[model samples]
Target: MNKLLVITVLVALLALSAESFRVPRQAAAEEEEGTLARITDTVKSYYEQSVNTASNYLESIKGMKLEEKAKNLFEETTKAVSTYTGILQDQLYHIFYPQN
Candidate 1:
């Protein structure tokens, strides 16, 4: 009877130690899953927001004339280039012939 009692106590101690180890592993796994779920939700939200922004931009430009847009863009580009060229010419002239 004494030997049986000893064996039962040993078995109970082993089971308690095993349970201690198992609890942390389960908790870690649950935490990892929660982190992954949060990352997935954030990525999905950003993707949806990007899609909505693109849809809104397309809707805003849907009725515009492409030819007129192109013409205006070209005019703006030409004016910018002309201004840059004039500034460059003035710098070169000053560099070659410095004023007194």
Candidate 2:
């Protein structure tokens, strides 16, 4: 009867240890999934902001009267697009080539 009790305690301890290890693994997977979801949301927001900015600029240009003013708007839009493109390219490059 004593030996049976010892065996039962040992089995219970091992089962508890196994469960503890499994819990951390499940928690780690959940944490990783949440991190990925946040990253995806951030990237989506960045693209939406970029799109909205470009659309607003285009809408503003649609009401111009003077040729000189239109030309200026065109130049400004070109500069803005170039800047945004450069930033996006850099971001993509960094994502593909993370050092750590």
Candidate 3:
């Protein structure tokens, strides 16, 4: 478990390192067009990869089926929403009834 967690963290860090590449400091005219194109293309590819990663993750979650687990999750989510709603109501009441 620990090894898997460490590997996942390392992979995530490495994934982010793709975006941290320093663009050439040279003037645009001085930099080769191919080099500029490569850098831009790499950034675009990484952006697409990140978006696909998120889309895939969402699809996985949407595809999951565990009725019992989902029931529990729904109940918990309902309680959370109720709690937040009550808090908001209290704040609104306080705003209207500042003396209270």
Off by over 4 Å in 1: 1-63
Pitting candidate 2 against candidate 3, the one with the higher TM-score is: 3
lDDT for each candidate structure: 0.70, 0.68, 0.72
Q: In model 1, which range of ten residues has the least summed lDDT?
A: 17-26
Order of all candidates by TM-score, from best down to worst? 1, 3, 2
- By lDDT, the best candidate is 3
Per-model TM-score on C-alpha atoms: 0.37, 0.34, 0.35
- Judged by whole-model lDDT over C-alpha atoms, candidate 2 comes out at 0.68
lDDT of 3 by residue, 16-51 (tens): 545446784657766555554565556567766776
- Name the candidate, 1 or 2, with the larger lDDT value: 1
Task: Please list the Cα RMSD from the true structure of every candidate, rounded to 1 decimal place.
Answer: 20.2, 27.2, 17.3
Ranking by lDDT: 3, 1, 2
When summed lDDT is taken over every stretch of 10 residues in candidate 2, the lowest stretch is 17-26
The pairs that clash in candidate 1 are none
Q: Write the per-residue lDDT of candidate 1 for residues 1-100, one digit (tens) a residue.
A: 8546655755554454343334453355444444445555565566567769989888778767777899999999999999999999999999999999
Regions more than 4 Å wrong, model 2:
1-65
Candidate 2 lDDT by residue in tens digits, 7-47: 57555544543433344533554444444455555655665
